[model samples]
Structure formats: C-alpha cells, structure tokens
Target: MDRLHARYPFLDAARAAVDEADVDLAALVRSGGPAVDRGVGRVESAIETGDVGEPRRVRAELLSYPVARVVVSLVDDPRLTDAYARAEARTAHERFVDDVEGSTPVSLPEGIDLGRLLAEFELAAAVDVGVSVGVDEDRCTVDVGPYLRLASGLEGEEWRLVARDLDGGRVPVEREELYVLLREAVRERVLAGLPLSVPEPVAETLEPEVERVARSLSDYELPRSVTAELTPAAFPPCVEALIERARSGEELPDRSAFSLVAFLAGAGADPETTAAVTGLDPEAVAYRHERLAGENGADYPSPSCAVMQAYGDCVPVEKRDERCERVDHPLNYYATAVEEVSRSEP
Candidate 1:
C-alpha cells in the first residue's frame, strides 16, 4: 500500500475520500441505471474493503461520467487518476481563463483573443492533445480538432488548414477553423501532462500569457541546497551537453530525460537543484528523484555513451577516443576527469 501510494500520488486522496464517505459511491454509479446497478454494488463493497480489483472492473463497465464520479470518490485508485486529473486540470484552467480575461487587457491576433490563445495552450499541454504542423514552401498546414474524437475512439472528418498571412486580405474559412483548432490542440496538451513544443512564431505571440499561466501553476520548486560538490567542469561531456540543451529549452527524449534525472539524484543533487541544472519542471524532478530512490533503489549509475547515442544525445567528439569506449558510465568519466585535474594541479 505504501509502495502503491508512492507510485500513485493521487491514491491517498482517493482512499481518504472513500474512507470518509465523502461521496456516495452507490448513488454516483446508480445514474448509469439498472444495467450497471450490480457493478455499482460490487464497487461499493470493494471500496469498503480496499479491494481495487472489483472497482476496476466496475470502472471498465461504467465508462461514462457517472462511473468516473464514483471512481473519483476512491482517491487511492490509479484506475481513474487520468480522468480525475484531467477534470481537475480543466477546472483550474477555466478559473485561470476567467482571471485572465477579467483583469488583463485582451488583444486580438488574427481575429483570435490572446487570453483564449493562452488558455488553449494550457489545456493542450495538460491533456496530451496531438496536433501536427507541417510546412510546405510558404504554407504551413495544421491538423486540428481530433482530440475529442480520438479520445472517444470515434472516426470523424479530418480538420486541417494551411497557414497564411492574416493581414493579406480575406482569410480562408479553413484557415479560420485552423486557428480555433490550433488553440484547442494547445489547450489539450497543456492539461494532458505532456511536454509541449510550439513554433517560434506562435511562442513569441503567446509569450506573456504562457509565462503567466506557468508562473501561476508553479509546477516546480527550486532546491534548498545542492549536496554534492558543484563541479560542472568535472561533468562528463555527454552530461554537460544535456544540461546545455535543457537550459536552451529543448525537449529531451523521454529516455534521456529520465536518465538525466536518475543520474542527478544518484549523484546527490536535491530535487530543486536537479530541476535547475536540468531545466526540467521542479515537480517532475522531485517525482523522478523519488521514483529513482524508492522503486529503483539508490546507486543507479548514469547511462553510458552508447545509451546516450541511442537517445540521440551522444556527442560524436566524446566517442572519438578509445578511452571513452572504455568508460562504463557517465559518472566514470566525471570521476576520471576530476582525478586527472587533481593529479595535474598539486
């Protein structure tokens, strides 16, 4: 149970809700009517005994909002964390939008409200909405508005548009729809707990609002202190390169990102310091550190050059020498570098 709580942070809240009877699990599922009534009874029994298996089955049968409400009552269950998180994030986003619109002076870019644009980006990132933008010569095409349909597993007409200069005469109907779709995509991903990347043009336009939303969320916190001796110069070339790329706001591959986090934790960097060093979200750094320390156990070594290369992060120059090949891990390189520097100095 402790391990489960560590693995799923939301479980604590769910479990508490169930124990306190904060929500009526039976009535919540009853909205699904007679066909799901039996499943609801089983879910209530499971919740009372902390038997996740039965409730999970009920969850599968009652896939609609009614079941989600019941599942949400059991805060300790991971079966519906995604649904719960999405709902909470959406509500937060709505409040954020209202705050932004009510206080700030709104501007319009290409007939779209700036506040709305920022909201869209926030939602997109939180929800993992998928939108692709492609460039062909002067025109940029964006695929839009498939997130809901995709989530429902329904086939829908493809929505797309070619980007054009809005100031250059009448905008095509598809282009207008494209703008709306673009916002929707951005909003979805913002809420989806996924890394977000936007075109430079779009980023520049949304800079202020983006910063505001991110600051408001404060998703990551700074480290109080760095435990290890700060030695950037002694770091392996691969690690140094990753740090630089992260600072420059490049979205690292998932493998590389996790490897960096694990290495930082193993090297005795606290979560906040790790976040600063890697330019990752603070909360994310903390979570990764916790996972590495708890589940993976301490002493996880930094990945070798070969593994780095597999993640598209290997610096070719670092591998030019046979010495680099002999090094078992990035930490070894750092150790060797520090030793050589110490020997040469005194």
Candidate 2:
C-alpha cells in the first residue's frame, strides 16, 4: 500500500491503491491479522477516544481503514456513524493543522495539502487564502453559502451571521476558524455514502468484529432521577462499571475517567467520596474535583448515552434495559433510578 493511502485511507488515491493490491475484504477478515485488528481498533478507538489511535504499521493502518468501514457498515448504527466520522475528521484536522503550520515533521511529503483539501471540498473558489491576499496574514473570506453550510453545526453567538464580520458575499474569518470550517467539511465528506452494503459472505466473515462493535452501542441499563443521593444501587450500569474500575485505583481510559468523575461530581458526591470510590490518591481526586467545579462553575454533565456508547464507556448490550431506551441522558436515568432506590429504602 502507498504510504499516503495508509495515512488517509478515505482518499480516492487510497482506494485505488487498495484496488491495485487486490486485497479482498472477505479473505482478509477470514484470515485475520494486523490489518483486521487495526481495522476493529479504528472504529472502537474512535467511539471510545474520538480518534483512530496513532498510525503503527503502514500496511495495517491503510488496510485498517477499509476494515473499519466494513465493520461500521455491518454494525449499522447512526451513533457509530456520527462518532466514527467525527473521529476521522478530528484526526485529519490534527494532521492537516500540523502540516499547514509546518510544526510536525512530515511523514509523507505529498500528503493532503491545504489547497487540494479545500479544492476537494469544492470550497477553493469560496475561501480567500489569507497569505495569498498579501495584506492580513490571519484573515480570509469564505463565501456565504459554503460558510453557512460548513459552520451550521458550530455553536456560540460568534458563529451567527449577524455577529460575523461580513464583506459583500463573504464572511471574514481568522485562520483558526477557517480550520474549524474545514473540519466540518471533512466530516461531511467522510460521512457521504455510509453503512455500505456488506454481502452475506463478507458479513459472515466479519461477524466477530460486528458483534464487538454492535454490543458497544448498548451502554447498559438503569433508570434516572436523584443523581446526588450517594446510593450505589441507583447508579446506571455504565456508571457502575466505571465506578468498579475507578475503585481499583487503576487509571481508567480518558473517556471512562471523565464519565466516572463527572457523573459522581454531578451526583453531589464530594471529593472525598470520589476519592474513596476511585481509590486513587485523595489529593489528585480532590484536585480534579476542584478543577471541574472551577471549569464549569457547577457539575459537568455525565456524558449522554450516545456519547457514552461511542466512547465505549458504556457496558455490553446484554446489560441494557428498557429504561436505557426510554432515557436519552445519563443524568435523566440517574434521576429516576436514584428516586426509586430512595423510596424503596424508606
């Protein structure tokens, strides 16, 4: 596989490289090895940590992208789709940003350049390159249509057109904002034509990978209400799992740790309580608790079900309940579940 293809498996050139190699998915999955492992890892890591982990082997990395697409297709969940696309876009953004700024050493001299990336998204005509303008080194204009389309999902009052620095048919933006818009474009491009058709033979070959990812979609069960009562029995399954892991004092993955601490902090659990459950250094846990309070000025919300599931912080499918279906957010589930526990105790 070409090095560029391994770096960006979504590219047409990458696809062509795969085709030229005659590496069939069915055969590859059946045989199984580094490529398949990396492929499964890509989807799982994206959902869990929000990026396909660092590139390891060239062939494995390139092949893994296709494997990941196939698995995501077989799994066929919109949450996974959203998570996977976001992760891919986020990952691409990091690489592209480093390359554009000339900070990170280039692994491939001809990887996706800014000009081609903009042109690929058909935004080349719409975006005014800042340096090319020969005046301001930090500002550029994006056509209204592309700007609106790309920045639709962006939050904050600053993203609004009325608040924007508009010049004729274009909206002025800084270099950083330009990258943010490009990230959205990358997400949309990656999300085009997804949940591809997986033939029975190929599907059968990829059953294990499908089973693993599909199960991740179910972040376990438990109803909501009264998240601050300090009742372990009232916690949702996903939270319970995190607590279990945290109590071991072994550091959980970043997402899992955030879910645990955030959920506990929201539940009116004190720093001491968090330390006790997590069994980590009391000072460290207390410091995190203080930071959380300072950062949000209140309890940070426990990650939502879709987010939890995507992050793999949620438990297996078999643990999910009807309440999991009824409730959209972890806080909501805890509210009801904690109420039930409180009432039953009295």
Candidate 3:
C-alpha cells in the first residue's frame, strides 16, 4: 500500500488499491501479525487518545484499518464503532491539513493532494478553493447545501448558519475551518461501511483483539460530558441494580445496559449525562438515544420487563419489592417510587 492509502484508508482509491494488491484480509487476521496487532492498537489508542497511535510500516498500517473495522464489527458495540470512526477521521484531517499547508503542486511526494481529497467526497464542485487570502482571508467557499450537510452536527455556534458568511448560496470558511468540515465528511465515509460481515475464521481469529478493545472501552475513564442529576433512590429496583453494577465499573450485558440508558433517558436524562452516570460509552449512548428519539424529542421507553426477563436482564427476585410486583414495567415502578419519594419529603 502507498503512504496515501495508509494515511486515508477510507478513500475509495485506498480500497481499490487493496483489491489491486490481492491481499486476503482473512489471511491477515488468521496470521495475527503486524496488521492485526496494529489494528487492535489503533482502536485502543483511539479510545485512550483520539487518533490511531502513529505511522507504522506502510502496508501493515493500511491493512490495519480494515482489520480494525472487522474487529470493531465483531465486538458489535456502537460506542466502539463511533470511537474508532472518530479516531480515523481525526487522523485523516490532521494529515490532510499538513498536506494542504505543507505542499505545492510539484513538491508533493506522498499523501493525498487537496483537489483529490475534495473530489473523493464529491465536494469539488461545491468547494471554491480559489480565493485571495489578502482580501477575505477565507480559504474556500463551500456551497450552502454541502456545508450544512457536513457541519450541522458540529459542536460550536460558529458552525451554525447564522454565524457564517453567506452570499448567494456559499459559506466561506478559513483553511482550518475547511479541514474541520472535511473531518466530518471523513467520519461519515468511515461509518458508511462499518459492521462488515466477517468470515467465521477471521472473526474467531480476531477474537482476542476484539476482547482487548472491548475491555479497554469498558475500563476507559469518562472523557467528558454533563452528568445527569439523578435520584438513584427513586429508581426502580431492577434499574437501580443495573446502575449500581455500572457505577462500580462492571460492564452490563448489552440488553441490560440499553434498558438502563433508555429508562434514564425517558426519565429526562440526556445521553451524555446518562453515560456519565452509568459508565456507558458516550458515543454509543448518544447514538442510541438519538436513533430512538421522536421528532418531538421524546425517547422511546426501555424494553418492558418481559423482554428484559427474556434477555435475562431482570434483577434477581431478592432485589424486588411489593412495588415491583404491582408494577408491570421498570418505568412504572420508577414513577410510583418518585411520586412517593416526593410526597414523603417535608
């Protein structure tokens, strides 16, 4: 693989290059060599930091991106997927920024050039790269539609339409600002092909690496988010049981974790706060609640007790009380408990 493929493996050309090399990804996984090792490290580093650790041997580094994807899909955790995708995108944006600022048409040797990068995402027609910095200091003007598609989810007010310079139909952005939107585009591309169907041999072969990354995420400290102000005392017995285990750093089963998060969210806790309190992966939590959210902004209810019981998510009989017997679902138990708790106060 070339250095450019190693740097931006999400590009279509990178995939085509791998096809040209006739590399058997399944064979790479079974071999458990540099590509697999670096693949695991790439994800671990993403959760711990924000980028795949650093440059390594070109071929191994390029192959590791797909290996990491399979490992992530095998793990099948939205949190891990989001984490890995962000790390890849972050690394690409940084490398592309260097390419943008550090290269000229002739001096460039390795890595993707700016024109090709935009064209890969079909943004060539949308991004006007020609601009006089002496006058506008704007690096480029992105058509309003493409800019909004990529920048709408960005965190800052500056990304908002009202905060931008809009003329006719384009949004002018600085050089670094363009890099940020491209980062989002990269993230979207990486996510588009995730959760690939892994061959049985490859899945079994990569199991250890998958387990390691899973444990890393489970053990990783909360990065940052608003904590939900919650009353555990008012929680239903079953949810309280799960929350206690989560707070103690035990990784709950997927169904159990989803139930707890959905319940807390339905109770008015945002994803960040729920993740903060329950040790759920923030990205997973955000994606879950976002997917299940209504147009009016309400979260769907957690799985009912029967579904939880079938999934073996219900707490043992000892954890329940008379209220639990009376109520059919966890949320119902919570409402009763919260109402009673409020009444018992002064």
- Per-model TM against the reference: 0.32, 0.65, 0.65
The clash count for each model shown is 27, 13, 0
Report the number of backbone clashes for model 3.
Answer: 0
Off by over 4 Å in 1: 1-228, 294-301, 318-323
Report the C-alpha displacement of residue 125, candidate 1, in angstroms: 42
TM-score of 1: 0.32
Indicate the worst ten consecutive residues by lDDT in candidate 3.
220-229
Q: Best to worst by lDDT, what's the order?
A: 2, 3, 1
lDDT of 3 by residue, 37-78 (tens): 888888889888878998788798888888888888898876
lDDT of 1 by residue, 1-346 (tens): 2322211113223245344545444443434443244333333333232222222322233332233233333222332332233433333334334433456633322222333443434433322212222423223232223433222211112321133333232222233333444433432432243223333553443344334333422221111112356567777667777888888999887677877876666456778888988889898777656555222222223455567777777777744455456565565565566667778895
Which portions of model 3 show Cα errors greater than 4 Å?
A: 103-111, 132-137, 221-346
Could you give the C-alpha RMSD of every candidate to the true structure, in order shown?
19.4, 12.4, 13.0
How does candidate 2 fare on TM-score? 0.65
Deviation from native of the Cα of residue 173 in model 3, angstroms: 1.3
